[model samples]
Target: MAPDSTPPTNEATAEFRAARDHLLQHRGDIEGARRLPRPEGAYFNWALDWFDPEAHGNDDVALRVVDLAADGEVRAETALSFAALSGRSGQVANWLRGLGVARGDRMLLLLGNQVPLWEVMLAAIKLGAVVIPASTLLSPEDLADRVSRGEVRHVVAESGLTGGFAGIGGDWTRIAVGEPVAGWLSYADSAAVPAPFTPDGPTRADDPLLLYFTSGTTSRPKLVQHTHRSYPVGHLSTMYWIGLRPGDVHLNVSSPGWAKHAWSNFFAPWNAGAEILIVNQPRFAARPLLDAMVRHRVTSFCAPPTVWRMLVLEDLTRWRPPLRELVGAGEPLNPEIIERVQAAWGVTLRDGFGQTETTAQVGNPPGLVVKPGSMGVPLPGYEVTLVDAASGAVVTEPGAEGELCLPLDSTPLGLMTGYQQDPERQAEATAGGFYHTGDVAFRDADGYLTYIGRTDDVFKSSDYRISPFELESVLIEHPQVAEAAVVPSPDPLRLSVPKAYVVLVPGATADAEAARSILEFARGRLAPYKRVRRLEFAELPKTVSGKIRRVELRGRENELHGSGLTGGGESPARGKLEFWEEDFPRD
Candidate 1:
C-alpha cells in the first residue's frame, strides 16, 4: 500500500510553503511574518496540493494518539506516518467516490479523535466534499438540527453514535466506523478498494470545504462555512503564532469537531510537517497528561485555559517536558495560569485569541515579549481595529476600550465566508465595514491588546464600565478558587454590581471562610469599581466545548437578585452558601 505520490509545482502549494517557511525562519520577528504574502490560487486543494506532496515518501510520525483511562492509565495508543496516512486517505477517497459521493457533497463527520476521523476528513477534502464536524457529545436533537441546517447528504459517525441519528429524517448516506452495523456501510470496507483516488476536476479555492457549528454559549449555534483555502491555507498565522517547526512533536489538547481541533491538530501541525500528539482520557487527569508530554518529548504544546488552570493545581515542578512553545486558547487565559507554567517550565504559557469565525487573529507569538494578562499583538495579516461600540468611531488612544473587529472589505482569508443561510445575522455582524468579533478589549501603549470580556458579558456598574475577565482573572489567583465567572448583579442604587460565581479546587468546601478568603484576595488585586460584591460557589455551566457560559450566570443573577426598582419587585431570596461583601466585617 506504499504510494510515493508527489504533485508538481502548485501555485497554492508553493505560495503556502513559502509563507510557512518565511514565518519559521523569522519566528522571533513579527514584522517579518506580517510581510509574508497571501496565497492566490484560483483552484487549490490542500490535501491534493499541499499534504499529499509533503507527505510523499516522508515517514515521520504525523499523528500520535494516546488513550488513557479515567485514572490516568494508558489504555491504547496509535501512531501513523505521513506517507501511511496519505496513502490510506487516498484509498478512502477512492472508496467514497464509488459510494456515490461527488463534488460539493455535504458530509457530517461525528466522531472522536480516532484515526478514521482524520482519514475521512482528508478523504473528503480530496473528493471535494464539504465537511461538517459535530462533537460526539451531541444528542439526537443536536444532530437533527445540524443535519437539517447543514443539508448533509452523507454522514460518517462512530458505530456507537449511530443511534443518535436514528429517525433524524435525512436522505443522507450512513456510514459507520469501529464495528459492524446492520444498515450502514462499514468504513472498514474502504480497505478492500485498493485503487488510489483521483479527483474529477480542480477544486476551486472558493468552493465550500468545511462547515462548523459554533459552540453556542449565548445563543443558538451559527453555521460557519470555510472555503478550500480558508482553513487549509489560512492557518499559516496559527502555525507561525504557535512557533510550529518541521519535524517537531506538537501536542494540541483539543477535541475533534471543534475549530481549535482543525486549527491546531489538523492544519497547523501538518503545515509545519510536525507530529500531532493527542491524549485521549476518559476523564482529564493532570498527572497522566504531563506524563504523556514528557514521554513523547513534546516540543510545542497548546491547550485551553481550563486545562492550564488544572495543571497548575498539580505539582508542576514534578515533570519538565522539553517544551519549546506553550499556548492557551479557547478563552482568555488568566495571569495566574500563565505565571505558574512559566515558573514550572521556565517557558511562558502564551495566550491567543481566535474563534470559529476566523483563525488566530491576535496572539503572543513565539520570542515576543510576553505581557501579563495580554493576548498580545495581532498576528500577521490580521489588521486588528478597536472600535467604540456606541459611537462607531475608531478608538486610537492606548488604554481605551473598544469592540475587537476586523475590517470586512479587507478581511483575511481565514475568516468564514459568512454565516451560512443567515443573511440577517451576517449583515449585523458585518455592519460598519467590520467583521465585528463581539469581543471587547483595551490596548497598551506598546500595541499589545488585552482581552476584556465579551461584548454582552461586559457591563456597566455605577456609571463605570466593568470587564468580567479583569475581575475573574484576579479571582482565580486565590489558592482556594479553581474557576470563577463574574456577572452583574442588580442593585437599587447603582443599577447593577459585579458578582462572582466561583468553583473551588478539589476538597475545598464552599463555606463562609472559603468565600471570605477569595473575596479578600480579589479585593487586594482588583480596583474598587470592579470588586466582586457578591460571591457564590458552584460548578459553572459550560458549553459542550468547555467554554464557560457567563450568559447563564448573568441570567441567574438577574432572576434572583434584581433590585425592587430594577426588575424584580420584591427582595430576592439568597442562594445557599452565597456570601456578600457586606456579610464580612469592616476593616
Candidate 2:
C-alpha cells in the first residue's frame, strides 16, 4: 500500500527544491544516501569536490579578513582567491604529512582567528586528519585533559598559547602558527613544502573529520566525533536556515575553536558560495562590530545572544546595516531582543536550535512565520519529537513540556557519531530509540519548539516548575541589565526561589534603586511563580567556550543552603542580594 500523496499549497522555494532533490537522490537507499560517493579525483574533498579552485581561481572575493591589532590599528585583508587558499593549504598539508602525520591522526589546533588557522584547517581536511580545535582560553589543566582524552598526536597553536602545554608530554609534532618558538616548527616554513599534495587514498564521506571537546557547562567536556559527511554535508540545512545566497557577504561574531565558529565561519557560508567576512577584535564593542558590518556591506549576520544584548544597548538605529538576513544561535534569543532588532533594522531575528553534537535541528527559516519565542520547526531531512522524561513516550499534545529528542532511525548527517571513550554515557544520552538532547522544550500546535532550559537547569520552587531561561529572558528586558543568569536559590518558606545573577550596563548603577527598578520591570512582565525573587550584581560564570555555566551558580546555591547561611537573616548589600515573598504580587 502506498501512502497518500499531498499536493503543494505554496510556491516552492529554492531551499524546498534543493531539499526535495536531495531526498530524491537518497530515497529507498539509506546506505547509499549515507555514503554519497564522490566522483573520482574528487572523492569527498571539499577543496576539490565542492570547490574547484581552478574554475574560481580569479574570483578574488572569497575571503576578506579585518585584523584589529593590539596597537588599535586596523589591517584590512581582501580578495584572497579560492585558488590561493587551496594552494597554500595544500603546501601546509604537505608539510604536515612530512612531519609524520598520517591519516586519521588527531591533531589539536589552538590559534586565534587568523589566516593560518583557516589555512591549517583546510590542510588538515585535505590530508584526511581529524582536527580537535581548542579555545585559546583553555588553561594548562584543560589542555592536558584534552591532549590525554582526545588521543592527539600533533599540536598546532599560536606562540602565546605554547606555555599552556609545557608539562604535558606526548610523542606529538609541535607546530606554531604565529611566531617561531623553541622546539616547534614554524608555519612560515610550510611555504617551502610542495604546493601540491597527492592523497594516498580516497577520503570516504563517512571518514572521521572532526573531534570536538564540547563546552561542558555542567560537567567535563565530551570528545564529540564527527564524520566527513556530518558537518560539511549536514550544514546544508543551516545554509537554508540562514537564507545564504551566492556572493553574499556573511559576518558572524564567533571566536575560533567553538562549534558555532565552524557552523557559520566555515561550512554554512562556504556551502552557499558566499564570501566569508571576519572582523578580528580583542573585545566585543557594539559600535565597532556594527560599523564593520555596514562598511563591508554584510548581507547576512549571525551572533550569540550576548552580542545581541550589547547591540541593543547601543543606538542601533544610527548604524543602519545592509544586512538582509539575521540569525541568533548558541543560546536562545529573548523575545525582547528580537523585537527591538526587528523594529530598528526592519529585519526579523531568526532563532536556531542545535548542539555541539549536531547541526541546526530547528530554525525559523526565511520567508517563514517567525514565532516570538519559539525556535521553529525541524529543518529538512531531520525529525524532532518531544518525549516524556519518565515514560519515554512521545507527547503529541501541544504545549506539554518534554525532553527534546531526535529519532535514531533517521540518522541525520549533522549529528556526531558518539562521545569518544565513554560508551556508557553515550548509551545514556542516546537512549529510548531517540537521541536525548538533554535540553527541555515544549512544542506548540504548529510544531514550533520553544526552548525551556537545560534538563538540569530547570528546577522547582513551591512545587511549580521554573525555567531560569524564562525568568532570565524577562529580566534582560530592563535596559539596565546587560546579561542575566537565573538559578534556584534556597528558601526556607517556599523551599526555593529564582535568583538572578546580573551584569549591568556601563552607565547603570548596581545599587538598590537599580535593583528595585529591574525587579519592578520583571514583576510587571513575568508570572507569579516565575518572577525573580533575588538579584545579585556579579559576573556570571562561563565555560572556556563562552557558554554561561549555570551549573556553577546552581552549585553555589546548594552550598549556601547546605551551610545554612542563606535562609532568614541576611543584610542586602550592593554585591549581595535577597528578596521577600511580598516583593512580587501574589496575584
TM-score of each: 0.97, 0.90
In model 2, where do residues sit more than 4 Å from their true spots?
1-43, 53-58, 69-73, 76-79, 563-587
lDDT of 1 by residue, 1-587 (tens): 23255545577788878878888888899988899788876988999988998888888899998999888878999999988899999999999999999999999999999999999999999999999999999989999999999999999999999999887875789999988988899998899988467789999999999999999999999999999878888898899889998888999888889999999999999998999999998878899999999999999999998888898999989998899999989999988888888888899889999999999999999889988999999998798999999999999999998999998777686888999989999999999999999999999899999999899998999999898888989998888888999998888888898889999999998999888888888888888887888999888999999999999988888787663532344544577778888889876
Model 2 residue 167 CA deviation (Å) reads: 1.1
User: Which candidate's lDDT is highest?
Assistant: 1
Q: Worst lDDT window (10 residues) for model 2?
A: 1-10
What is the model-wide C-alpha lDDT for candidate 2?
A: 0.80
Residue range 1-587, candidate 2, lDDT tens digits: 11123312222122323442453354333333334332222236554445443214435466788976544457665456666777778888899999988889999999877888888888899889999998988899999999999899999999889999999998888888776799988878888888877878778777899999899988878889987777877777677778787778999889888899999998888777778898987776777777788888999999999889989988789987788999999999999999999889999999999889998888887777888888887876478888989888899999999999999986865888898999988999899888899989999887889999988999999999998888888988888899999998877777888988889999877877777788888988988888787877888898866689998998887776745543456832223554443554544
Clashing pairs in 2: none
Most accurate candidate by TM-score: 1
